[model samples]
Target: MNAHDARGSTQLLTRLFDATPSDAELQEALKAAREEYRVLRWWKLGQPAVDAIKVKLDIPQERAGSVLTELVQLHSDKLQVTVNAFPYGLPALDGVLVDVTMERQVTG
Candidate 1:
């Protein structure tokens, strides 16, 4: 999907969860999903899905950003990456909302 379509899908899915999940909670969920996807696919560590799957998992903004930065540095030679987070809801400690995605470019 195009960037706009992908973003729309992320937002739609994020709504399925609680109106707001903390950054830590979102990161843990995304990390879990990515690990599952990787094991199922038997893919290498730095594949495109490594990042996109993280996004598809729906992580929070700050944690996702931190995780993506660490991943990028750790796998700099194997992956090229882009990360995005869509924040929703009011900016508050209890009601803050965010959707995060990390995109890894695939090269032949």
Candidate 2:
């Protein structure tokens, strides 16, 4: 498989292996991640338009818009950081890796 395909496959497997959290916990995590993303975007991009945020995340513009909406609903508070996706190789599968970036918010 090509590098891109391998990475995507690896990501899918990783998602499957990660321990599943309760719905409430998952919601909380998503909320926190969204808030962190917004604060960082505002600081770095100056309250960028929705389309811009999507481009930065490498996700669809519509998804980015949805994320922005959710962020607004959850927390008006702002923080600074960037979320990036990277390629990680699969532990068991040979020549397979997935694109996944760590969700990190830069804080002083």
Candidate 3:
């Protein structure tokens, strides 16, 4: 199906930030607390979502995620970003199988 037909689909872009310390020694690096990563979603009205991340992280106004073309330009050493697109509809389900788990696990 076309983009317009993918009603429930969205493009997700995630940014990861890690401490400068080595992973093996991370636990001992008490001063190097890891920061939380941020994710951005793209859609017809997705600018506001991007803006929210910018505001929450105090990102510069110039680093807005309004357009995909500009997304890379806004990148910095502060974080690493990965983009993924999921467009689901008749086209995506042409031969896909659906499975459900009926078993529930018990915990103490």
Residue range 20-90, candidate 2, lDDT tens digits: 44668768976866654323222112222211122233333334445544434432123222333332235
Candidate 1 lDDT over 1-108, as tens digits, reads: 543444433433333332345678878987875653322222223332223433323444445555455545633333344444344445633221232333344567
lDDT of each: 0.41, 0.35, 0.28
Give lDDT: candidate 3, residue 48.
29
Model 2: how far residue 95 lies from native, Å = 34
**Highest TM-score: which candidate?**
1
- Number of colliding residue pairs in each model: 0, 8, 0
TM-score of each prediction: 0.30, 0.24, 0.19
Report model 1's TM-score to 2 decimal places.
0.30
Q: Candidate 3 lDDT, tens digit per residue, 1-108?
A: 443332222211221222233555546543332222122322222342321132112122232233233344444554333332232246333221111111112234
Cα RMSDs, all models: 14.7, 18.8, 20.6
lDDT of 2 at 98: 17
Give candidate 2 misplaced runs (Cα > 4 Å): 1-17, 38-108
Clashing pairs in 2: 7-97, 7-98, 11-98, 39-79, 40-81, 85-101, 86-100, 86-101
Candidate 3 lands at a TM-score of: 0.19
